[model samples]
Target: MSIDLKTIKHISKLSRISVDEKRAEKLAGDLNSIFDFIEKLNELKTDNVEPLTSVAETTLKLRPDEVKSKNIREQIVKNSPQDNEDYFVVPKVIE
Candidate 1:
């Protein structure tokens, strides 16, 4: 399928984009060339080609799920605007 000037104009109007006749013609040609390239690719025989699962051959190594936080409670609590001994003091929103 190829894109025409009329199709480009309609698309521009539907997308609320302003395209002049000169620019619309250029866009139509560019889109037509892209479609032509896709058509050429479709003509190629890929009957024996294996579908790609991943770019890399190796599987990702996953680490065991575990808590890794070091004891930094005092450091974090220092940044709180109003702090209790071991909790955050915020304006109570719920009744």
Candidate 2:
């Protein structure tokens, strides 16, 4: 399959990319070259080749979910610069 200037213009319109006449002509040539390379790849014989998914053979190790602390709210609030017993006070950031 080959790409033409008309097809490139249509593609540019669909993608919302502004393409001038000179650029569209260039795009047409570039797309045609890509398609030609793909066509050449399609001609390759790979009947016995296995489909590859990943280069590395690694498995993720998961740890059991458990809470380390039960009650530490008083200790955490003591370290704050400006603190309220219920929640930490923050400086006004938005107008």
Candidate 3:
């Protein structure tokens, strides 16, 4: 596929980019080259190729989940300016 000046201007508008006529014409040529390369790639045969999720062969090591700290809610809540038995109180802002 070939990119024209109008298409380049449209792309610039959609991307919120400012481009002059000279730059847009240059960008149109650049985009046409990119599409031509993609079209060339599409002509290649890769029916036997397998999709790859990762290039490296490795597994993640995970540790067993366990609680390392005891309950300290009462100790921490003592520092709060306003807190109830099991919750913190804050001023309401909504009407």
Candidate 4:
């Protein structure tokens, strides 16, 4: 696959980037090189390879869900600079 000058201009327009006539021609060449590299990668054989999530095999340790701390809303809210009966209070912004 290869990119053309007209396609490069269209891409520049879509990306909202300003490209001079000379730069557009250069961009087309760069895009063509990228597509050529991708085509070369496509020729590689990976039939026996497994999709990898990480470089090494490891297990993530998980703990059983249980309540570790008792609720202390009253004690926590007692020292608040601004708080309501059950939540923090903030200055109103809208009129």
Minimum summed lDDT over a 10-residue window in model 2 is located at 51-60
TM for candidate 1 is 0.72
Kindly indicate the candidate among 3 and 4 with the higher lDDT: 3
lDDT of 2 by residue, 1-95 (tens): 99988899898899999999999988888899999999999999989988777877677799999999979998888876797797677778899
Candidate 2 C-alpha error for residue 30, in Å: 0.7
Cα lDDT of all candidates, in order? 0.90, 0.88, 0.87, 0.85
lDDT of 4 at 51: 92
lDDT, candidate 4, 6-81, per-residue tens: 8988888999998999998888888889999999999999899999999888889999999877988888777766
Against the true structure, candidate 4 has what lDDT?
A: 0.85
Candidate numbers sorted by TM-score from highest down: 1, 4, 3, 2
Off by over 4 Å in 4: 76-82, 88-95
Ranking by lDDT: 1, 2, 3, 4
lDDT of 1: 0.90
Off by over 4 Å in 1: 64-67, 89-95
Q: How far out, in Å, is residue 57 in model 2?
A: 5.2
Candidate 3, residues 26-93, lDDT tens digits: the string is: 89888889999999999999999987788996789999999887898888777766867777677787
TM-score of 3: 0.69
- After aligning candidate 2 to the native by TM-score, how far in Å is the CA of 28 from where it should be? 0.6
Candidate 2: lDDT over CA atoms?
0.88
| Residue range 1-95, candidate 1, lDDT tens digits | 97988899899999999999999989999999999999999999999999889878788899999987889888888877797679777778999
Candidate 2 matches the true fold with a TM-score of 0.60
